[model samples]
Target chain A: MTGVETLIAERSASATAVIPDIAHYLLNAGGKRIRPLITVAAARLCGYEGQGHLALAAAVEFIHTATLLHDDVVDDSALRRGKAPANQVWGNAQSVLVGDFLFARAFMLMVDAGSMRALHVLSRAAAVIAEGEVRQLAAARQIATTRDQYMDIIAAKTAALFAAAAQVSPILAGASPRVEAGLEIYGRELGLAFQLVDDALDYGGVAEALGKNTGDDFREGKITLPVALAMEAGGEAERSFWARTMGEGVQGPEDFDEAVARLKRHGALDATLEQARAHAARAVEALDAAPDNVWSQSLAALAEFVVERAY
Target chain B: MTGVETLIAERSASATAVIPDIAHYLLNAGGKRIRPLITVAAARLCGYEGQGHLALAAAVEFIHTATLLHDDVVDDSALRRGKAPANQVWGNAQSVLVGDFLFARAFMLMVDAGSMRALHVLSRAAAVIAEGEVRQLAAARQIATTRDQYMDIIAAKTAALFAAAAQVSPILAGASPRVEAGLEIYGRELGLAFQLVDDALDYGGVAEALGKNTGDDFREGKITLPVALAMEAGGEAERSFWARTMGEGVQGPEDFDEAVARLKRHGALDATLEQARAHAARAVEALDAAPDNVWSQSLAALAEFVVERAY
Candidate 1:
């Protein structure tokens, strides 16, 4: 963790005053460093005793931070992690540019890791994440977004990075192909579980714990699994309600309450949680081929922790 | 040239509907394919007869296109290459995301080029270009921006990719380090000349010839070398005018005419043109150690063409 902290500070440090300021501001804001933790844990599990994992972990964190900055702009959200988003503080243009700076920094760190395989994995993930974001944008406010489409979006936007973070370490450690594949699966499942929990929490979870309002996604017209499911089960009135509030961007103070009620009536939140738990189980199951060590044990526990956010 | 075109279309083709649509809209729009041409010409000059250069050329173009998409968003421009900016057509969110997709696609091509050296060169250039944009953003509308600072900005933002595009081919061809270094210098100076001509044209060139309107940089409050020079030469009244119009963003319709008058009165455009020619000469001179091939001759002519835009 200290290694990640050091390298992150060193890499994000820029001569352009605002680049590092905005980058470090969002980076230092509290969030679970789950992606980097996965990277480091995977490297440790793969018996990588060298210092290379530090840079790799930092690189993964940078990529995550970059995407978050860009996501805030795309979402037009004013806050992140209970603080003013970087875009709010520095404006959208600066946020976009700094996100780009962090992306470039991520690649620089990847190059430093000295693994072409890691570079390829992470670069491809970066692209997939962007595509996923665009896909989400296209699906925004659409009531008919299918469960499969939602899964695909989250897999590319979230799970791809997680999988890349986990898989690259095995490549660095020169582990077997089976080990690499197993860690990738574990990371991907864990990522899906984590995102699903976040989506469910948007309707019913505590605002303090969730770091933003309970219905941030709802306000943004994001068609998450809960909303997608509720639409599928709802009758004529419920479908129209979704269309007006989300699709037509006509919302009032009471709209969120109604949304939560509809979701609960349709068992949408619970169903989402159920899906997350299943993925969490699969995540733990993925470690069957990985080395059994302290890191692997923590990783298994981490998978459960991801789904527990729904509670 | 056809090879570059085919590869660009092939690589940017995405299953995600909007990604390729937006990318191709901008790619197919009429802008000279100068960057990709430089890449292919560099490869040909180095006697790289294989098919690898096609992908690399396409990759360089993607990087350029990606930056242009993001640049439009950052600059808040309404037009690109004589058409409505992609942000106007699909919105800023899509433009930013698609730019990211192109970047990822560029990296995928670099990986396919089968050279770590090429990957390192282009990836580093990508980072430098992003940093250059950020630097430009920080310096925007500042009358005190120095000529050296402007030179540094153009070198990083424009010339870095050009140099990288040229240098990469020799690496792919397994040519000598001396040849690689020469191509890099040639590309760097050529790019500098290209950007200087653009900066000068922003003050006085015809809009039809330039593809975008004249005074775009002025309208954006961009502190190019011409503006920097004119500011240095002007006295109290001119400085206050610039400060009020550019620095304070208090521009009227007549401000652009005034800006042009001040630039011409101070001979800033001519000075900028002189600097461009000097860089163009250097660009041609850089090929001293490179192979004396038809590609090299064409490259030298291309350098002249870049500066010729000033006339």
Candidate 2:
């Protein structure tokens, strides 16, 4: 983890003054670093003992940070990781351009790893993630968004990176195809679980615990799992509220509180947690195909920990 | 060229609705198509008869179009290719996300080419281009920018991709290292000439001919070559004018006319054209290292044509 952090700092330094400053501002800010951790853990689990994973881990984190920078611009976010968003500090133009720089830096890291297969996997994931963001943008504020559509969005936006991060490690380690496939599935399921918990937390999770405010998704009118579930279970009056606040963008100061109350009444948060738990369980089960080692066990424990954050 | 156009259309067609819509909007727009033409021309110059160059040419065009989408957002332009800018029509969020999608699609095209070396060249160029953009953004509205600094910015922002696009062709064709280096230098010089001409055109070029309004760089306070040269030669009153109009963003309706007059007084426009002509000569000279062929002769003519647009 320290190596990845150091590498990120080293790679982001540029002749252009603001590029490094804006990138490091986000990189140094506190987050779980869960994506890189998964890459490291996957490599260790596959019985790899080399330095290439550090580059891949850093690459994964860079890709994640780049997305966060762009996502803030798209969402017009004020804060990220409990601090002012990069876009707020620097203008949106700087934020967008810096995000592009970091993305380019990520590919440079991958190229340095000298693994064609890894490059292919991660590049494809990059595309799918962007596609997913567009998909989510298209579905934004639409009350008719189905649970299945939400799942598809999250899988591409969130799980694709997770799967690629884990899958690349096995490729670097020269592990068997079966092991690579197993880890890929494991990472994908775990990522789905993580996103489900995150979506539910936007309504009910503690702000301090999540390092972000609650009800952000509601304010943004993001149609996450809880919103989808609540719309499904609500009556005509409740549907009208969602339509006015979300679909019609007629949100008031009291709208978020009332939306949370409605979510509770519909058991939307709890049902979302239940769905997350199922995916977490499947994540652990997917690891059964891998060798039973300390790294694999840690991965399983990590899956549980991801879900545990919601409670 | 038609094959490249067809491939770009095919590859950019996505199941995600907005991705294709915005991508096709820019792809079909009547830009010069200079970058992709370089790729195809270079491939044929290297005696490549295979169909792989089609994918590569399409990939080059996609990258160019993707940058255009993002550039429009960064510059907040109202028109592109004589039509409403994608950001203006689709909103900033859609434009940004769709740009990302096209970038991903460009990588997919490179991957399909099955050349690791080509991927590395293009990916590295992507990073350089992004870095150059940030550098340019940082230098924005600063009239003190030197000719050397402006050159560096355009080389990375504009020339890097041209060099990479040309370099990749020889790699795919299994050409010699000397030939690759020669083409790379040729493309870099050509790109520099192209961008210098573009910067000059913003002041005096025809809007109808250029497919966008003139004085865009002046209004945006972009520190292009002419601005730098004019700043170098201006007296106290001229310097104050530039500072107020560009540095302080205090432009009036007549400011652009005043700026152009000052440029003429300092011979900045003519001097800028001279620099572009020098680079164009170097581009043609660089190609002499390669085998003498009809393709190389056409490339020389293209270099001349790139600069002729300024006249």
Best by lDDT: 2
Return the top candidate by DockQ.
2
TM-score of each: 0.97, 0.97
Shift in Å, residue A253, candidate 1: 1.2
The deviation in Å at residue A129 for candidate 2 is 1.1
Query: What lDDT tens digits, residue by residue, belong to model 1 across residues B1-311?
Result: 99889888888887899998999899999779998888889888888898888888899999899999989889976468888889899888998899888888888888778787788788788878888998999898887888999999999999999999898889999989999999999999999999998888877757777677787787788889888888889878778988888888889988899888889999999999999999999989999889898999999999988988677
The C-alpha lDDT values of all candidates are 0.88, 0.89
Query: Which stretches of model 2 miss by more than 4 angstroms?
Result: none
Each prediction's DockQ against the real complex: 0.69, 0.72
Model 1 chain B worst lDDT window (10 residues): B203-212
Query: Which pairs of residues collide in model 2?
Result: none
What TM-score, to 2 decimals, does candidate 2 have? 0.97
Alpha-carbon lDDT of model 2? 0.89
Which segments of model 1 are wrong by more than 4 Å?
Answer: none
